[model samples]
Target: MSKKKDNLPNPFNEQPLGGLLKSIDGFFQNAFQNFQFVGGFPVYEYETETHYIIEAELPGVKKEQINLDIYSNQIKISVESSEVIEEKDDKHHVYKSSNSFQRAERYIILPFTISQKDVKASYRNGLLKIMIPNKKKRIEIE
Candidate 1:
């Protein structure tokens, strides 16, 4: 009686798709590294007979962190934030700290020119409201 022993690599233990998956994951991670999740807030624009109104919803933003600029026919809004985190361990005599800063800006163009003096802005409840007087003059039919 003779016994034949065959040695073959097990296919189940080999991960053929592992490298592909890792490459795909790395590609996506690198692609999205510069993508901003909070690029800008939601803005609503409307006009009445006398004025134009703009409302922006900025959650978790402080009023002092917002800057508004009015041009002849455009409005620019800028928001900036800074955060600091520190951790200390008395027993290990270790201290760690980190700081991060973020800034976002948006621009809105108007159909007509606007006076900077007539523009008014207010922030309340994380909402920024801007009012600009309309410069268009209505003509009467003769």
Candidate 2:
């Protein structure tokens, strides 16, 4: 009988808990990969008999930090905000400060065309409201 060759030590062997740990890590990474840390506000849209209304909730956002634009068939809303924090220690003479900025944008499409001159927007108490007149033209039958 021919002698069997001895197997060398394998470095590629999986540890008992390595696979489980790796799977858990991967799950967490994928779960939070596309998560937004800021800028995902809620919006509501509805239409009345003569006009369309859109409302957006923007808590803690100042009017200066918001930008609104109305096109012939769509509306665009953008918000930008920044925060700063400071810490001071008189005894140790140490001071620290940090700043963070966040931005978010959203677009809404209208079922019908709209005129820029007929659009109105107002912001109050953390709510932004927009009104667009409905101008449906009637077609005469031949």
Estimate, for each residue in 1-142, the C-alpha lDDT of model 2 and write its tens digit.
9999889754444654665577557655644233242647788999888889999998667899899887778899988766665779999797756555667888999888887888999999989999988776679999
What's the lDDT for residue 95 in model 2?
A: 75
Candidate 1 residue lDDT tens string, 1-142: 8988778875544565665576457655644233242467788999899889999988667899899988889999988876665779999797756555677888999999887888999999988999988778889999
Task: Locate the minimum summed-lDDT window of 10 residues in model 1.
Answer: 29-38
Residue pair clashes in candidate 2: none
TM-score of model 1 relative to the true fold? 0.69
Per-candidate TM-score against the hidden true structure: 0.69, 0.62
- Model 1, global lDDT: 0.79
* Cα shift from native, residue 85, model 2 (Å): 2.0
Off by over 4 Å in 2: 1-39, 138-142
Residue-level error in angstroms, candidate 1, position 13: 22
Assess the local accuracy of residue 75 in candidate 2 as a C-alpha lDDT between 0 and 100: 90
lDDT (Cα, 0-100) at 52 in candidate 2: 90
